[model samples]
Each structure stands twice: as C-alpha cells, then as structure tokens.
Target: MPVIALLLLDGVPGPHVTTPGVCFGTAARCHPRVAYEVRLCAAPGFRSAGGPGAFGVTTPWGLDGLDTLAEGDTVVVAGHSGHPDGPPPGVVAALRSATARGCRIGAVGAGTFTLAATGLLDGRRASTAPGLAAELARRHPAVDVAPDGAVVVDGPFHTATGVLGGVDLFLRLITLDHGDAVAVETERQMFLELYEPGPDQGVRADAPLPGDALGPTLGWLEARLDRPLTLDDLAGHAGLTVRGLSRRFRAETGLPPLQYLLRARIQRAQRLLERGDEPVARIAARTGLGTPANLRHHFQRYTGTTPSVYRAAFRSLVTSLTPPREVPPPGPGGPPAR
Candidate 1:
C-alpha cells in the first residue's frame, strides 16, 4: 500500500488533518489494492487550531513520518497559522527532502504559504484558497497562482483549497493510482454516505461543449485515435466544407480540429504511459504520433515533460519530479463532426 503522510504543523485546523484520512481511508476500505496507508504526523511544531472551542487535536507520528515518503508515498502539508514568510525549520527541510526522494507533495489552504516558503513551487502553477491566492502570489513571485479551480495538479505537487478541495485532490489521486471505474465507485460510496455530489456532477458553465451535435464524429475520431487524420479528411467525413467544419467544430469543442486531435492524442499517450508497460515508441505509434521524437515534442509542449518522466513520476507512485504541465492556451477551430 502507498503511504500518505499528513504533515501537521502548529495552528493547523483539525479538518485539514482528518479530511485526507477519510477520503483515502474509505477508498482503501473499498479497494485494498489501491489503498493508502495514511500517517498523520506532527511537524516540528504542531498545535491544534481552528476547531470548535471544545475540541482538541493529536497524532501518533512526528517528523519520523517523513520517512514514509519513500517511493510511492505522498506527503500532504496541512494548513496552519504559522508564518508563511518563515515556516518551521524542520518542516521546510523535510518537504524539500521529500521532493528529492520522489514523493508527491501537496499543500492545503494556507499550507500553500508554507510550500511557497520552501521554494519548491517556484515557477510552478499552483492554487490555494481563493482568499490566499493573491497573497501567495505577492509573496512568491516565481509561483504562478492559478486564477480559478479548487484543485490544481502540477507535476509531483498538488494543492487544494481546504477540506472539500482536499477531497477533490484525493479522488484525483485515486483515479491516477487505480482507474476511472474505481474512482467512480469510490465517489459513489462517498455520496451514498455523505449525501455529496460527485465531481462529474459539477460542470463549469463556460466549459467546452459536450459534443452533442458532433457526438458521432467525436466517437469516430476517438475510435481511430491511431489514424493519421487530417483537416481535409475530417471535413470529408463530416460532409462539410473545410471552413464550415472549422466553424462548427470550434463552436462545440472550443479548439481547432487539429489542436483538438493533438490534445486527444496526448491524453491517450498519458493514460498508456501511466497504466501500461508498452514502450514509448509503441505508445507513440498507437497514439498516432508516428514516432517517439514527434511524441516527445507534443508531450512536452502540453505536459511539460517527456512520456518517460511522466510515467516514472506517477507509475512508481512518487520518484520523479518534473515541472508542472500547462493546459494549452486557447486557440481556434476544433475537431471533426459527422
């Protein structure tokens, strides 16, 4: 089982500690094969804060829990009231050490302040609680504070707002470690007991179309992900002129047809790299990238890392660190429709 160390610092709210445990623990109970052994550890200076006046907090582990972040382990820094300008000494060192050791590091709420203080998030895109994002950006010029999103996954580091956001992060991790089917099952269980909606239930209004009109064409393209597709071919299949196809495709997918194909190919490449043992060359062929060299170019362009590095970081559970991947900036046109 993968170990998840919850690093608790002084003045941390109680929920920040328990939420991850509940999320990972429930998933573990449901699927032991993908279970995480959660360890709540007291940082160099841990104290309970932000709970009900009558409540208190405690943990069984301390700095030694940092050791659990060996290969497939994760270390999540719980939010605290301590100085963001200067977090506790041992904790910063520990976080840096964990990064070097290939651990997937995460911060929650104000805990992002501590992460920023460590210089790990420098040049990486991250998100914190909405109210704290600007402050984090102001404090760390190298860290790009994402304008929106409750959960943000860069490379090895993940960050979220608070308890609910942490849940989103854990669910994502579950999907990465297991698969969508298992993640969906676990999510259904969470909702059955907590009366909460799953992530799919929350849709953004400004998001791209669900491909209603282009559904059949979208399905055709996805089914032929390995094909050497082209704009003219797509237009022919859709029974429309190239210009007409571009207009409707952009209207629905919010991306030009070629760009959309690239995204889809890269997405497929990522899945194969993470869950399969196929060689990079073979994956490239199957994803229709033609060659490993070409695959590397587009993979790095979109995910900011090579397929090998991405696989190493996630497949091994935690062991490689690469810069966070960026979403492709918006462009024109979109995929084919029929």
Candidate 2:
C-alpha cells in the first residue's frame, strides 16, 4: 500500500479536488490486498472547495502540515487554484523539500505552473493545458512544455494538461506503481465509464473487399507493427511487384500504402500510450517507430503535439471525466474507449 499525499491549492476546481478522493477512496476502501491512502493537504487554514460557511470544511494541516512528505511517498498538486501564476512561498518550499527527499511529484493542469516555479523542470519535459502553455513557456524558457496531452510524466515529475483528466493520470500512476491487473480491477470495481485512452487501435477495413488483394494486405501491415515494412516489404506481403501493390493499395484506400501505414502507425502508438504505460522507447519499438526521437518526430508532425504532451493531456482528460473507482456505487462509470 502506498500513501498518496494530494496537495490541494487555494483555487483548485471543485471537481479536481473531490473526485480523486472519492474514486481512490472507493478503490482503497473495497480492495483487500491493496490500499491507497490519500491525504488532502492544503495551505494552512486554507479551504478551496465548499467553504467554511457552506460545508464547514477546514484543512487538518496547512503548509506546516506538509511535513508528511518523505521518501517512498507521492505529492500530487492540483490545479484551478486561485493563484496558479505561482504557489505560495511556503508551498513551493514543501515541494522543493519533497523533491530533495526523493518524493515523487505530480501536477495537474495549471498546477504545473507551481512546479515550474521551483526550477526543477528546467531542461526536463512537462505538460500543461494548451491555454497556459505559452505562458508556461514564456515564464520558464528552459522548461519543455507540452499542452495538449492529458498528462505527461517526465522523469520523476508528472503533469496534466487540464483539470479534466487528473484522475486518469493518477490511476496511471497507481498502475505504474502496482500493476495493470490491479489498476484494471479497481477500474472495473469502480465502474468508471468516462475514461477513453486515445487514438484508435482497431484495424479499419471496408469488409467484403470484393476480391481486393489489398484487404489481407492491410491486416498484414498491422501485424508487422514491430518490424519496419517499407513499400517494397508491403508489396512483397501482397504478393505483387512494388508498382502493382502501390497502385492497388492507393486505389483501394485513397492514399499511398506508405502514407496509410504511417497514419496507422501513429494511431497505434497513441493507443499504446494512453491505455498502457509502456515507455516511449518500448512503444517506439513495438510500433516500428524505432527510437524515441523518431516517435517524437512523427508524433509532432501528425498531431502537432509531441507524444509526451499527448499522453499528459489524455491522462488529465480521463481523470477529469472518471471519478475514482473507489467512489460509492454509480459514481462514474463510462465506456472505456475513444
């Protein structure tokens, strides 16, 4: 069991603050073998949601209470804070101290703004919502920023694009710490339905090709995701000369075989990233993208955002939609496909 200290900001959106607590709360409460302990730590006497007057809420510990941060623990920073331009000095100190002690750090949406304040993201990769990317880049020119993905896990730091997908990013982190089976079981138990990974992994075919030689050829192309299949290679698989296969494939698909293959490759890479926590290197290999550099190169050209950013945004979006599976029944259980 891992204890997750979820750091709340002054302006964190109501949904971002409450949903993870409810979802993970349910998951941890029901599961016998694994338990995820979550602590809601806010600035001293600072109440973000359901104010003292409305819900009579109060934080157990302010910044001073942040002493719980230590090794083998995680610090999750939430967004929608009143002052996202930066975190309070004391809060910043806590995050820096946590990092010094080897505590894993994560931020959601605008929360990345605070992490960047510490100079830890310099030359390191991170993600934020598109609305704030330019400002993030403008303020900290040294930190790499990706604003489209639901979330981005760079080194020990995890970032989300917006408040929408914070829970998904958190679940992915749990999956990274535990395992897929645990993560999936929790999800199933929670009955979460709002989560949609990314990119389409299904093979596309207008069934009954009417004796189209290129029909099986498409499946063959998909099968060789791990191997580089050039036009010649595809032609070989189709049992035709290079010119013949190229013409046929293009005529049938309305695109050149190479172009279609590249699109398919990028889409598959996307699915692997959003649903599975495979490293960019492994995904690159499995998708025949070869290297991380190559994956980023193709991903940027196709999606206008790097794969890293795309993953972050995807996670953030998922989290925002799907509350913790731990929430009492009928909380949030959406379909699990995009």
Candidate 3:
C-alpha cells in the first residue's frame, strides 16, 4: 500500500496528531481494498508539551524514519502548540528531501506556518487556521495566504484550515486514490457526510437545514416542483430580491437557488425511478422537466447515467435483495396443484 507519513512536532495538539490517522485509516477500511498505510512520525526533537488530552503523544517513528516516504507518498505536517517559527532543522531537511523525492506535502492548522518556513509555500496559495492567517501572511511574504478556504490545494501541497479540515483533506485524497463511492462510505463511517462547500463553514448533511431563513421557502418550492418556478417566484416567496435570495441560497446550500432546484428535481426523479415503475415521460413531467429528453439530459448530467439505465440498475439491485420463491415439483402427468 502507498504510505502516508503524518509528521508531528514537539508540543503538537492531540487532534493534529490523531485526526489524519483516523481519517485515512478509516478510508483504508471503507475502500474495497486498503488505500494507503498511515505512519505517525514525530520530529527527532519531539517533546510533547501541552495540557490535558493534547500532551505526551508517543510514536514509533521519528524524523529519522522518514526514509519510508517515497514518490507518490504523502507527508502531513501537524500544527505545533508553540510559536510557529517551525520544526527542528533536521525535520525541515527531511521534509525538503521527501518533497524533492516527489512526495506530496500537507499542512494542518498552524502547521502551514512550518511548511511555509521551508519556502515550498513561496508563491503558493495556502490557508491556515482562521485566526492565524494574518500572522502567516505577515511572516511569509511570498506565500499567498488564503484567509477563508477550508482546504487549499496548490500543486503538490495541501493546506487545511483546522483539524476537521484535516479530515476533509484526507478524505479528498482518498477520493483521488480510490473513488467517490469509497470516500462516501468512509465519511459515513465517521458519522459525517461530504459537504460540497467543505465543513469549515459548519454545514453538514445531518445538520439541520438553514430553517429559520429558508425552511418555509423550501417547503413552498417542494410543493410546487410540478410547476414552473423561476428565480423571481423564489425571491418573492422569501420576501427578498433576486440578488438577496441568490446570496442566501449560496450561503446555505453552496449553490445558486436554480442550481439547488435542479438538483432537487433530479433527486426526486431518482426516487421515482428507483421505487416505482413510472415512465420517464411521466417522471419528467411531474418533476417539471417538461420532456423526456430534458429529463435525460439533466439526469445524466447530475447522475452520469441515462434515466433508463439508472432504472435498470436500481431494479437489478432491488431484485438481488429479494430471495427466489421455491416451486413444488409436478405430480403425475400434470403440474402440481397450488
């Protein structure tokens, strides 16, 4: 398996040390086959220094053990609790050598500062924790500090905004290694769902929708999916202008209102295709897609398969779930009685 070297520094927080392991380790299990091997490595000068649950982490590998990092392997730098000056010179050299050998680099939380110190982030766009972005920008003049992104990927480096962002980054890497299906299962195992806008914005699948602002509007829209609804209708229903409604929809769902509506229609069509034997024409009409060709276009665009093919696949899956019934043998010259 490909290996991921999770580098921890002295005084690093516990989550920074553990989150990468859990995320990638769980991904390995969730995949049909193991995706990557995770190795926890502490700097040679590592001395855990913090309070409560975040202190005194033990690791089997130190900076010296980074010999295992090879081309296509990953090196994740965890944030330290001390000033963001950087890790030991030995650790920096090891990271630089590993990068030269074609290993991908990642920084979590304030670890971006350490990676920035190596000058690899020079002229690269990266984001750190929300509060530390300013200091990182001030300290590293050449690095393009992204103040608001949860996860920033520029070339061979990946930088995350916080510990949870670390989880997202690993999951994204898993998706790149495996596929979206494996990543979805992995996220499910973590009791989380992949939020399109990234979780740094605090939105998640299981979390309640933005009800106070859009609940009534959503209900109004759902009740009228069979009818043609425009942006003006949505804005008027929500008592907002078009621009205001668009902004609120983007904030809540990470998409424009029309885009969300299109997704919603496709989802509804998917349910009908899976659970019922409705014709594509009827489904299309009911979902306000107007015509079968239009439904097929949008359906394939969103789901990557034609409506008929999707229905066949769903039916095949449903059939596999049901056991076959046994039939009695025929008696005499005639068939057996019921």
Candidate 4:
C-alpha cells in the first residue's frame, strides 16, 4: 500500500494530525483495496498545541522517515505554532530530499509556511490561513499566495487553509488515488456533503466568487436558476453591457456567463438528486435544464455518470452504511406498526 506520512513538528496543531487520520481511515474502511498506510512521523520532542492541554507526542517514525518515501507515497507537513519562524532544523533538508525521491508533498494551514521555507514552493501557487496570507507572501515573495482558496494544488505541492480545508484536501487526494465513487462513499460515511473540486481543477468550489461588482447579480442569477436566463438578462441585472459583463465574468470566474450558468444548474441538479426523491424530469425542470434528456446529457458529460445511476449509486452507498431499524412485531394490529 502507498503510505501517507504526516510530519508532525513541535507545537503541531491537533487537528492537522487527526484530520488526515480520520479522512484516510474512513476511505480505507469504505474501500480497503485502495487503502493507504497512514504514518504519523514526528520531529524530535514534538508536542501538541492549541488543544485542551499540551502533551508530548511520540511516534514510530521521525523526520528521517521522510527519506524512505517514494513515488507512490505522500508526506504532509502539519501546521505548527512556530510556523511564522520557519521550519525547524533538518526539516527543510528532509522535505527537499523527499521531493527529490518523487514523494508528493502537502501542507495544512501554517504548515504551508514550513513547506514554503524549503524553497520548494517558490514560484508555486499556495494557500495558508487567511490571516497569515500576507505574512507568507511577505516572507516568500516568489510564492503566489491565494488567501481566498480553501485548498490550492500546484504541481505536486498541495496546500490547504483551516481544518475543513484540510479535510477537503485529503478527500481530493482520496479521489485522485481511488475514484469519484470511493471518495463520495467516504464523504457519506463521514457524514459530510459530497465535495466537488472547482472547475479550475486545484481550488475548491467555495473559493471567492465574482467581486462586489457582480455580487448582487450573481445572487439574482441564483434566485432565478429555474428561469431560462439569457446573456442579456445577466448583463442587465449587473447593469453592464454584454461585452463588459463577459469580460468581468471571465476575469473573475474563468468562464463565460452561460457556461457558468450551465455548471451552476448541473450542481443544483446534483444536490436535488442526492438530497431528495425528485424524478430526473422534475430536477431538470427545477434546475432549468429543460428536460430529463438534456439533464442526462449535461450531467453525464460533466459528472461522468447518468442521473439515475448517480442517484442509485449514492442512495445505495448511504443505505449500505446506515443501520437497519428494527420494526415492532405486529403490535396487535392487521398492519405493521409505524
């Protein structure tokens, strides 16, 4: 099995260690065939921070363990309280060596600063906690810091901000290793909504939307998803000309107005399919896809599965994980008691 080594440094935050553990553990339980070996590799004399109480953390592996990782394995640097001061001694070299051996490197929250200190993230796009974004950029001007991104994957370097952002990153990693089905199953088992990576490939969908200029217009568009909206309608709502709206919209969202609208419709359809028993025709109409056939074409094109199959697969996964409730043994009535 491929290994996932979480490098725990001094003053490591508790969640950084537990998030990956839970995420990968859940994925393993859901699909053992693609399970990865999760290792908590700590630095010498590592301790927990920002928890109920600080405590010593002993691990089977240390910083040197990073050298053992190879192509299929991954090493994630856990965020630490000393992140602003840069990585401790031997960390930068150990991480660099791991990168040389083709081990994929990742970081969570302030851990991005640790990875950045090694010069590996220089000239690469990354994200840290929103509050530390400016400091990270100031310290490492070569690194492109996208403060608004929940998670940013540039090449083999993956970085995420905050606790939930770490979960998103690991889920994405699971998706890449296994498949969408396994990832979705893991998400459901964890009682988390299915997460879809943004169209930009690296960022999550919750990243900042269009600027204030089109904020209200975007809300207006969302309120009218069931309507057959035209480009002119969007422009009029934004109080801008069609050409201007197209330019600003593309600049902010990286897609044309209609293209973005189609994606939004498809996403809404997905939510409806997952959360309700609505038929494909009804969902299609509600999402403004016009008909079940059109919905299937676009949904399959975008999500790689037909609407019915998608719904059945998700529902079946949920059913498999849910415990069966016991029924009362015919409470002295002709019909079974509810």
Candidate 5:
C-alpha cells in the first residue's frame, strides 16, 4: 500500500493531447483497489504544451523544482521533455536532489533521456520507444539501453517505450508490487492487444508477420497441442524455412520455435494437471513431452516443481487437500533430484 508520485515534468504535452495520459488514466480505472496514491506535479511557471491558453497548473513548491519531490517516493516523468541536449536547469537540479534523497525516478518514452541526463541510468538497463533507443545510448554513455522493448525495469527505475506503451510499463510495476493475476486482468480490461505483456516489443496490431501463411500456422499450432508436431513439421506446414519459422515465431510470440513449442506443452500439462488426476507419464505422453522425465526436466525448469507436485499444489483449491510436500516423494530413479 505504498504511495507513488508520478511527477509530470514541466513542458510535457497534456495527456489529452497524447497517449500517456490515456494510458495512465485507464490504469487507474483498472486497479482501483490496489493502494496506489498517484499525484501529478508541474514545475513552477509551467503551462500547457500549446503556448497561450494551457490549463492553469499550480504546485505547493514554487518553480523551485524537485523541491516538491519526496524522498523514497517513485517519480514518473511522461511525454517529450522539451530539452534533448540535456535536462533543463530546473529539471536537472530536481533530479539530482531527488536521487540524493534516494528516490526512484522513471520516464516514459523520451522522458528517459531526461533520466539519462540525471546520470542515474549509468550502467543500468533502461529503454525508450524504438526510435529513441539509439539516441539515448549515443547521448548518455552510462546507460545500457535495450534495442527492442516496450519497457525496462532496471533496479528501482521503471521506464516505458513512450506514449503508446506506458501502460504496460505501469502495469508491470503494479505486477511487481501486486501480482500477475491482477496485471493480466488489468491489461484485458483496459488495453489494446498490442499492450499484452508477453512481448517486450510494442508491436502495432497492423504490422504483418513473416508471411501470411505463418498466421494460420500459428493458430493451427495453438489449436492442436495434443499432436506431436516438431519444428520441421511446423516449418513445412507454413511453407517456411526452419530459420524463417524461427524468426516469425519470435516476432509473433516473442519466443523461438522450440521454446514456443515447449511452452505449449507446459500449458497443456498445466491444464491436464488442473482438470484431472492423471499420472505424470500419461500427461507427458499426451502433451508430446514424451516421458515423465522429459516433462519433469522442462516442468521443473519452468515452474520450479515436478508435475504431480504442481498438480497437488494447484488441486488444493477445490477440495480438502494435501500439500505438495506430503504427496509422497517422486517416483524412484527418475531424474532423482527433481
């Protein structure tokens, strides 16, 4: 239930004029119950993005800047920060003071440049929208920028890919604080399909994949998890080369062909574990994991537990149950330590 301060840096485009405002507003709606106390602040003498008649803004701290920033609070700067060469005098002073007081600061999109100017991003993995990725690295030698990600959370800082992908970043922060069950529902309730968390890239909905045939093949693969389909078979089915299939799968699902197939098997195993009490070997064979040992190899690698243990751990929801530890040890000599 900690409070967060989402400081709207001076000279940013009004939310009504940009997507950041839309994303933040929608996030507030979705997680109404989470204890997030968000406050918006503008430096002294700030007005709307358009010169003349901007909405009148006032703050407790006169244009003194960062004076209003509280220590140990989370600060989020949004939209384009009018200064790219470096942070404005007021912005720079405030960022330094806030960091000196141990505050966590972040920016959405180009705002990252401002954070970079503060030197807090030095040696940190931060990101901005795709276009600005190179500029951020070039301008600030200390920051380690990700080439393709909608958001990057390095240590205390949380950054976004700008106006369109800020919500994903915000919700990711929320998930780190709250949980994914809430994060998933929040995305489902408020965002476009592009905002989904699986892909760090904020790919637009209109973009095309490797080829038109890859789409149907992806859907076909998703629908037929019960079948033993290999990477070669998938490539053949899509009329794509193996390399082409790998690239397209990475583009579409943000995972390689074999990795995606492994996930599909795990997901299938999870469903079977939850719905029925079948032997691990049976579930493995049915889901194309081949054997219980193979299933445990991937299962433990991904979920940190074996199939029966996972089943027992999850099955406690519906009936008077036994915890995983009491389920009698895993079968003999089968990947002994798993």
Candidate 6:
C-alpha cells in the first residue's frame, strides 16, 4: 500500500490530525483494492491543541519517517493552532528532502503556512483558510494565494482551506490515484457531494454554494431545472439587473449566471443518471437541457465523457460492489407480513 504520512506539528488542530485517516480509511473500506497506509508522523512528544481539551497524541513515526517515502507516496502538512509561528527547521528540512525525492506534498488549513516556509510553494498557486490568505500572501510573496478555493492543486503540491478542506483535498487525491469511480463510491459512502473543479479554474474547487443574497434564486433555479431560464430570469428572481447579477453570481459561485445554471443542470443529470436507468432524452429534458444532443454536448464539455458512458461506469462500479437484495416469498392471498 502507498503511504500517506500526515506530518503533525505542535498545537495541530484535532480534526487536522484525524480527518486524513477517516477519509483514506473510508476510501479503502469502500474499495478494498485501493488502500493507503495512513501514518501520523510528528516530532517527539507533539500534542494537539485548540479543541475543548488537549490530549497526548502518540504518533508512531518521527520526522525522519519522511525519508522512507517514495515518489508515489504523499506527505500532508497538517494545520496547527498557532500558525503565525513558522515550522521548526527540522520539519522544514525533512519536507525539502522529501520534495527532492519526488514525494507529492500537501497542506491543510494553516499548514499551508508551514509548506510555504519551505519555499516549495513559491511560484505555485496555493490556498489556505480564507481568513489567513492575506497573511500567507504577505509572508510569502512569491506564493500565489487563491483565497476562495476550497482545494487547490499545483503540480505535485496540493493545499486546502478551512476545517473541512482536508476532506475535499483527500477525496481529490483519491480520485487522482484510483479513478473517479472509486472516489465517487467513497463520496457516496461518506454522504459527501464530490466537488470536482473545472479545468480552467487552476485545479481549484470552490467552497459550498453560498446561502447569501442569491440563495433564493439558486433554490428557485433548482426547483425549476426543467424550465428554460435566461439571465434575465435569474436576475429578476434575485432582484438585480443582468450585469449586477452576473458579477455577484460569479463572485459567489465562481461561475457566471448561465454557466452556473448549466453546471447545476449537468450535475443534476449526473445524479439522476447514477441513481436510475433514466433514458438520456428524459434526463436531458428533466434537467432543462432541451434535447439529448444538447445534454451530450455540454456534459462532454464539462465531464469529458458522454452521459451514457458516465452512467455505465458509475453503475457498473456500484453494482459490482453491492449485493443483491433478498425478497421474502409471497403468501397465497397477499405479500408476506412485515
């Protein structure tokens, strides 16, 4: 199994220490063939802080454990509470050494600061907790900071923002390692919506759809996915002019109004396709794509695969893993009693 070593610094947040294990562990359980040996490596006697209580976390490996990692392995720098303080020299040196050996590196939350300190993120687009983006940019001027991205991947370096950002980051990593099938199954088992970023977005996934001024409009659009909606309709629903709506919508959802609507429609079509054997034409109509040809065009553009192929791949993976449900025999006059 490939190793996913989570490098823990002192005062690391509790979730930062545990989320990787949960994510990769769940992925392994969901797809037995795709597994990772998750290791929590820290300096001697490092304990976590910033939750309701502090506790001793006994990690099996020390910083030197990073030396054992190879090209296919990964080292994730977990977030610490006192993030303003730079990481220790030993940790920085170990990370630099690991980079030299071609190990993929990632950082979660404030740990982006730690990775940035090593100059590995220099000239790379990285993300951190939204509130800390300015400080990260100020401290490491060479590192391009994308404050709004939930997860940002630049070459072999990956960075994620916020408390739940690790989940997104690890899922993305799993997708890269295994395939979308495994990652989608893992998401289903974990009850998480897979947040695949667009190609032009610099490998950046946006945070959850906002519940701000556009919330009502978004909800309305979702309810009426079967209807033809224009920019004017969305702007009118949101009580803004077309230009204002376009600007604000892009600012909030990271896509222009019509583009966001198209994405939403495609996503709904994806779910409908995965859940049942809905004919492509019906699925397209239900999602307001008008015709099967239009659906195929946009779906291919966004997902890089035709709708039927996507459905077949997803269903085949799911069906292979799931056992058939057993049904009780019927009685003479009626179905068997509960």
Q: How many clashes does each candidate structure show, in the order listed?
A: 5, 33, 0, 0, 2, 0
In order of appearance, the predictions have TM-scores of: 0.56, 0.54, 0.56, 0.58, 0.49, 0.58
In model 6, residue pairs whose N, Cα or C atoms come closer than 3 Å (at least 3 residues apart or on different chains), thus clashing, are none
- Which regions of candidate 1 are displaced past 4 Å? 52-54, 83-85, 163-165, 194-338
Clashes of 6: 0
Candidates' C-alpha lDDT: 0.74, 0.70, 0.76, 0.78, 0.64, 0.80
Candidate with more favorable, higher TM-score: 2 or 6: 6
Please rank every candidate by lDDT, starting with the best: 6, 4, 3, 1, 2, 5
**What tens-digit string does per-residue lDDT give for candidate 5 at 1-338?**
34355555556655513443444444554444345555656643345553223454444443244455565566776655464756655776776777777777778877888788878889999988778888888898789898875578887788877543366577677667546645544553353221233332222121123454466776677676667888889999888999999888776656677776776677678668878878988998888888889998987775556777766756454343222334456677655555
Candidate 5 lDDT for residue 44: 39
Residue 57 in model 2: shift from native, Å? 3.5
lDDT of 6 by residue, 1-338 (tens): 89999998888877777788878887776443566999989854476555645676888899978989999999999888766878875988899998888999999989999999999999999999878999999999999999685689998898998455387789989989977756765665454333333444211121133446677788888889899899999888889999999998777666787887887787788889889888999999999999999999988887777888888877776676454666867769986678
Q: Which lDDT tens digits does candidate 3 get at residues 1-338?
A: 78888887787777777777778867654332456777888776788844337567778898866786788899988877764556676877888899998989988888898898888889989988879989999999999999774789999999987645377678778877766756655664564222222222222111123334787887788778889999999999999999999999877656688877876687678768867888999999999999999999987776567889877876775576344655768878987586
Candidate 4, residues 213-322: lDDT per residue as tens digits? 66787778877899999999999988899999999877766678888788778767877889999999999999999999999998887666788887888788668745
Model 6 residue 66 CA deviation in Å: 0.6
TM-score of 6: 0.58
**Model 3 segments beyond 4 Å from truth?**
49-52, 192-338
Q: Whole-model lDDT for model 4 versus the true structure?
A: 0.78
lDDT by residue (45-147, candidate 2, tens digit) is: 3555533222333566556545766777788777754544566658778888888888889887777888888898999988887688988889889998885
Model 6 lDDT, full chain set = 0.80
For candidate 4, report its TM-score. Answer: 0.58
Write one digit per residue (lDDT tens) for candidate 1, span 1-338. 78888888877776776777778767765543455788888877666655533245768888888965786688888777774647876878889999999999988888888888889999898888777788888989999998664678888999887645377678877888877756655654554342232232211111122436766676777778899999898888888888987897776655677877777787688778867899999999999999999999988876667788877766444222222557665556854443
